[model samples]
Target: MRVSVVINPKAGSVNPGLIEEKIRSALFRCDLVFSKAKTLEEMDQFLCEELAHKTDFFLICGGDGTVNTCLQYLVRAEEDLTKIPPIAVVRSGTANDLAHEIGISRRIDQAVRNILEGSVRNIDIIQISSGDKKAFMLTNGGLGIPAMTADLANQVRFSLQKVANCPQTAGFFKSIAKNSYQLIKKIGPGVYSLMVAEALRTWDPNGWELEFELPGDKKFATNAPIVLVNNQPSIGNKFLPAPFTSNTDGTVNLLLAEGRRVREHLSSFLHLRNGTVSQSDRFTSYEITEFKVRSKNPSRPITFFGDGEILFKDVAELSVKCLHKGLPVVVGSPAWEK
Candidate 1:
C-alpha cells in the first residue's frame, strides 16, 4: 500500500530524526512519500498531490490543530469523497485529542503499526457556516468558555513557538513546555477554569445573549456563560463533555452551561471533568442532527471556535450540522471507547 505521511515539523516536541527512523523501520515494504508542512500553503500543496494520486493511507503526524488544518483542506477540495484517502493520526501534538479518542498510540512505531492493522471507519464531521463562509470540524467547537480557553492556549503556544526559533531561548523554552505539556494535558479542565477567570476580567463577562434552534421548530434563548457543541465525546483530551457521543452517530451534542461567577465556573468545570455536568441544573445537554445559533444582540458579535481554533471571528450567527460519515478515518479501535 502507498502511504502519504505528512508531518508538521513544529508540532509539539516531535523529534524529526526519530520519527523518520520509526516510519522507515515500520513501513519498510510500503511505498512511502513524506512531506513536511510548516505553513498552510505547503499543507494545501501536499494534500492536493496526495488526493490526486489517491494514496491509500494519509497519515497525519501532528497535534489536534494540525489535524484540523488538514481537514479544512480536505473538505474544501473540489474532488469527491472517493478522492480523499482514509486518514490516520499520530500523537505528535500536545493535545492529541482525536488521536486519543481513537486509541492512536503516542509511540511512533506503535502508531505506524496501528495504521497497518487498523480498520477504516467513516466518521461524522461538523459543518459550520457563517453567511458565505464555511468550515469543518471533526471534534468539537464552542463560543463562551471553550473559545476563551482555546484562544489563550493558542496565544501561549504561538509565543513559545516564536521564541523557540531563537537559538538562545530554544532549549530552555522547549524543556519547560515539554515537561509541562503532559501534566497540563491531564489537568486541562481545571487549568481551563483558571484561564476562563483571567479571560472574564478582560473579555465580556456578561456572556452572550443567544438563541438556539433545533429541529422540529424547537427554540430556546439563553444567556449562558458557555456553549459547547461536540461531534466527539471529549474536549482537549481531558474533559468528557459528551461521554455518550459517537462521532459516527450522525448527530452532534450541545452543552449549555451557566457559570457567571468564578466559583461557579470552577464547580461547573469540575463536573465537566467528572462527566456529570449534564446531571447538574447548571447545564443542559442535547443531541441533535442540526442547529442554528444566533446572537440576540447583532451589535455584539460573538466569535466561534472549532477544534481548538477560531472558525469565525466577530460573527453574530452560525449554522452547524452533522455530515454523517462525512470522512473516513483509520482507527486503532472503536472511536467511542476512549
Candidate 2:
C-alpha cells in the first residue's frame, strides 16, 4: 500500500521529527511508498490531484483544523466522492477529537500498530458553504454564545502577556469568569443571552426551541436554540455528543441546547469539556443529511468556529450538509483485542 502522511508540526507541541521516525519504522516492514504533506496547501493539492488519480491509503497527523483542511480538499476534488482512499489518523493535535473517538493513540508505535492492524470504516464529512466557490469541513459549527466565548478565550490569553505557565482549559475557564465582567461591559449581556439564543423560545419543560427543519421533512419547524452538528461521537476525546453515530451513518447528529438561561451554560460548558454535554438539559440531538442556516442580518459580524478556531463568516446564509459516507477511515482497538 502507498501511504501518504499529512502532518502539522504544531498541533499542541507534536514533535515532527519523531512522528517521521515512527511512520518510517512502520513502512520499513511493508511494501509501501510513503509520502508526506507538510503544510495545508500541499495537503490540499495532494488530495485533489494526487489522490484523484490513484487508489491508496492516506494518513493525517495533527489537530482538528489539520484534519478538516485535508478533508475539504478531498471533498472538493472528487465529484463522484464515493470512491476514495481510507485515511489513517495520527492524533497529533491538541484535541484529536476524531482520533480519540476512533481510539487512535498518540504514542507512535501504538498508533502505527492500530493503523496496520485496522479495518477500513466509512466516515461522514460536513460541508460548510459560503459565497465563495469552495467549502470546508464543518466537523463542528457554533455561533452566538459559545462562539463568542471561543473568541474571547484567545484574546484573554494574548492580552495577558500572550503566554502562560500552565494554560489548561480549566485555567481558560477561570480567565473567562475573571474577564466576564469585561466581556459584559464590552460585548453586553446579549453575549450570554446569545447562548440561550435569546430570539428563540423553547418549550418551558422540553428545553430546546425545536423549530429547525429536519431534512426532507420541512412540514414544520422544531424548536432548539443552539443546533450543533456532530461528525464524530466525541470532541476533546471523551465528550460523546452523539455516541451512537459512526462513520457509516451517512449523516451527522444535530444537538441543540434548549434552555433559556445563561446560568445553565456554566454547567453545560463543563459538560462540553468533559465530553458529556449531549445528555444535559441544555442540549438535545438529531440527525440530518442537509440543512441551511440564516443569520439575523445579511451584513452583520459573525464567525463559525470549529474545534477551537474560527473558519469563516461575515455572510448571512450557510448551506450545510453531510457528504454521506464519503471517506473511509483507519481504525484499530488494542487494549480490548487481547
Candidate 3:
C-alpha cells in the first residue's frame, strides 16, 4: 500500500522525530512518503505532488486546522467523491476534536496502526458561504462565544511566539499551553472556559441580535450570545455543545443559547461542560439540512468560525449546509457511535 503523510510540525506538543519513530515501528512493507507542511504554500505543493503519485491514503498528523487545510485542497481537487482517497487523522495538535470524535488514538504507534487496520466511514462536511467566498468545515462552526474565544486564543498564541524569539523556547511554551488545555479539558471546563471568562469582561448583550432561517424556511429571530453548527459532538476538546451530533446523518446539528446575563450564562456553561446543554431550557437545538444566520441589526456585523479557525468576519449574513457523506475517513476500533 502507498501512503502519504502530511504533517504540521507546529501542531501541539509532539515532535516529528517521535511521529516518524512510531510510524517506522508500526508500518512495514509499505511505500511511504512524509511531507512537512508548515505553511499553506508548502502544503499545497505537497498535495499537488502526492496527488500525482496517486497516494492510496492520506494520514494527516495535526489538529483540526491542519485537517481543514488539507480538506480545502481536496474539496476543490476532485469532483467525484469516490476518486478521493480515505483520510486518517492522527491526534498531534492542541484540539484534536476530529480525532477524538472518530476514536483516533493519541499514541503515535496506535494511531498509525489504526490507519493501517481501520474501517472507512463516510462523514458530512459543512459548506459555508458568504457572498462569493466559500469554504468547507470538517467538524464544527459557530458565532458569538465560540468565535470570540477562538480569536482571543489565537492572539495569546501569537503573543507567546512573538515574545519567545528562540524557536526552541517557543515550542516549549506551546507544549505548556497545550498541556494546560488538556488538563482543563479533563476537568470538564475545556480551554474555552477560561477564555470565555475573560470575554465576559467586555461582553455586550446587544451584540448578537440575529435572525436564523432553519429548514422549511422557518424563521426565528432573537438575541442569542452563542450559536453553533456542528457536524460532530464536541467543541474545543470536551465541551459537548451538541452531544448527540452525527457527522454521517445527512443533517447538521444546531444550537442557540442566550449567554447574556452572568447567572444565566454561568448555568449554560455548566450544562455545556456536562454535555447537557442540549436539554437545557436556555438553549435551543435543531437538526437541519441547511440554515442561514444574519445580524438583525445590520450595523453590528457578525463573525463566524469553523474547526477553531475563523471563516468570515464583518458579514451581514452567512449560510451553511450539510453535504452528506462528503468525505471518506478511516476510523479506529472505538469510532464514534453513529
User: Per-residue lDDT tens digits of candidate 1, residues 250-269?
Assistant: 99999988766777777777
**How are the candidates ranked when ordered by TM-score, highest leading?**
3, 1, 2
Question: Which residue ranges in model 1 land beyond 4 Å of their true spot?
Answer: 164-194, 200-203, 333-338
The digit string of per-residue lDDT tens for model 2 on 174-261 reads 5665465344334422333343333223213232222344576563343333456677665444345666766567777767665455
State the local distance difference test value for candidate 2: 0.60
Query: What would the per-residue lDDT of candidate 3 be over residues 60-137, giving only the tens digit for each residue?
Result: 998888898898888888878777888988887766788888888767777887766788998998999999888898
Candidate 3: clashing pairs of residues: none
Considering every candidate listed, which one attains the maximal TM-score?
3
Candidate 3 overall Cα lDDT vs. reference?
0.80
- Candidate 2: C-alpha RMSD to true structure equals 8.3
| lDDT of all predictions | 0.80, 0.60, 0.80
Clashes of 2: 11
